[model samples]
Target: MAMIDLTRGLRSHPVRPPASGIARRRSFWERIHLDPWLLGMLLLLMLAGLVVLYSASGQHLQVPIAQGVRFGVALTVMLVLAQFTPATFQRWAFPAYLAGVLMLVAVELIGDMGMGAQRWLVIPGVIRFQPSELMKLAMPMMVASYLCRRELPPRVRDLAVCGLLIGLPVVLIAKQPDLGTSLLVATAGVFVVLLAGLTWRFIAILALLATAALPLLWMNLHNYQRQRVLTFLDPNSDPLGSGWNIIQSTTAIGSGGLLGKGWLQGTQSQLEFLPERHTDFIVAVLGEEFGLVGMLAFLMLYLVIVMRGIVMAGGAQNTFGRLLAGSIILTFFIYVFVNVGMVSGILPVVGVPLPLVSFGGTSSVTLMAGFGILMAIHTHRRLLPR
Candidate 1:
């Protein structure tokens, strides 16, 4: 035979198309791991947020610009995270969770103080970040990874171990006096547990125990934390102090009837009646400027995104992926629910931002990164078999 059979050789060793041709076929954005539906939702939310922020900031040109910059940075993080495969996330899951705990410990040792809470760690001349935010993402991953390794309908021991894993970070965060984040972090882990097939009997027992311990828990709360609970009961109790924000926010929202007073015409925001109009209470501005119509539209968009996220979770290739994606979606809805409920005078103000609509770079980035993990679960090739 000849050294090579031309047709057989060519058939056995196929050549890839030219690099230039391949490059021309797909742009960087096209190659990135992102769901177009989710991306569209995010972009629309940002646009709505910026429009509201502009009016909320009294039409200050720079405010929206700054928010836009934060969005761009967060978007970059999401896209980069998307490039990672689910296997990579799985491999890194425990390590990331451990690192988050170590960071929480570091925060306890040398965290910075701001707004009367030790929630952030800021170097004298370097970066500042919140360990709790890291926990928000890490908690679910750790729980999912551990649970997936065990049998379905985990035994008591598995549940105990899961509780320990969750409680450790919660205690650390609560010690930081950030009740909001501690609660959220715990919920994130718990969501994974429930979705992992934890029995309902245990859930009900826990609920009963929690109810029985409410008085004790109340006593354990810090003065301000206790005040927030009481304030939720009666805003008029401290209207000039803790309650002023809630009172003002409700007024702003209620005043935005049918079609609102027209854009940039909200007396509550423009006249400076609502506090934190650009951040936690931005939804109040939306309610004031766009009226009921605007609020409903925004809610619809948020619901769709939440549903899509849940759908992705159910579609995950493996158990870990399912638990993680589902928890993230549940936690996201919790964020939105808590913020809106607080502003609407039903829930206590927990210092939660309105998810993607709030003017918080840290929260925004953390959320987008979580979505990255979600996209990774959905887009990555089948890793572990079902």
Candidate 2:
């Protein structure tokens, strides 16, 4: 009767259809909405990363095959994670944050150190993963859960608590001597705080304090870390030593000219002249082989992902969902920005991979897991609890 009244005389028109069992079945499936465009952008980036990895690896069989296997595994992980909602995530956020912190502490006590950093926990007959990677998701979840119960802007005391939460992980990661991951995690946490409407004055003060501490930070940094900062200022100062990576990267990028040197034909990569060809410096390989056009396409894909994330954040119905979505988006931006900045010689080389493109299973899997959480957040934002 209500439907008849709603439709009024239109119900008598030919457009009206009879409700049947088949219609009900169709409705059920139609109600289950998925964001295909965002998912497509994600898949495209991963594919590009895989293709680039194949190109960048000097020993194609060793790096490319392992990367392909890991990419498949990461896809499975992403699928599993995509099934859960943000509220389900909220229940475990604190525990996940605590566990991640404990793992960081454990690394200091009993971790397998490699390349001057105790960043991985190698379990027998299992995966060797970085605990710091978990912070990419957990930190945002932890911060979002805290900020959701408050007003738009938080109080000073609330800000202090946020600072402490951010500081603990940053200090632990930095002590791992992994300055890059630590910076990314710090940015992830702080991004949520800023999105929660922290005051402009506080942000200004924070920047000023960071600048003020640079001299002090410089004094305490490890020699190599310090060298990176100085080299960033002027790569030519030590072109054959600490500055070699950036110089090669810039030269490769410049030598690509308008189009490129062609696939599998980069002199810098093929001749074994470029350092870290398949990892931190992979972008240089890409620049040399695919030129500015390919670089711009890559950036466009990244921009699509970023914009889609912002849409998810805006579409979110609750504070936690909004903040979590925004945090992930911001963290993604930092990853791209740092990689490009370092490769372009504007920032120091601090060992950050170019998202899915680098030949690192651990990082690739972790990033996919984070994206899965984002999908879950976005998909369940407006759904009613069954």
Candidate 2's residue-wise lDDT over 1-386, tens digit each? 44555554766655655599877765543344345677678778878887778778865776777888988998788777877878888888899999999999998889888977788998989877899999988898898898887777998888889999999998899998899999889999999999998778988998999999999988878888998998999989989998888999999988887788988889988887889988999889889999998888898889888898888778887889889888888788788889988998888888889988888888888888877777777777554432
- Model 1, position 27: C-alpha lDDT score: 44
Please list the C-alpha lDDT of all candidates, in the order they appear: 0.88, 0.84
TM-score for all models, in order of appearance: 0.90, 0.91
Alpha carbon deviation, residue 384, candidate 1 (Å):
10
- Measured by lDDT, the strongest candidate is 1
Q: Which ranges of candidate 1 are over 4 A from the true structure? A: 1-30, 383-386
Indicate the worst ten consecutive residues by lDDT in candidate 1: 1-10
Judge candidate 1 against the unseen true structure and give its global Cα lDDT, from 0 to 1: 0.88
RMSD of 2: 3.7
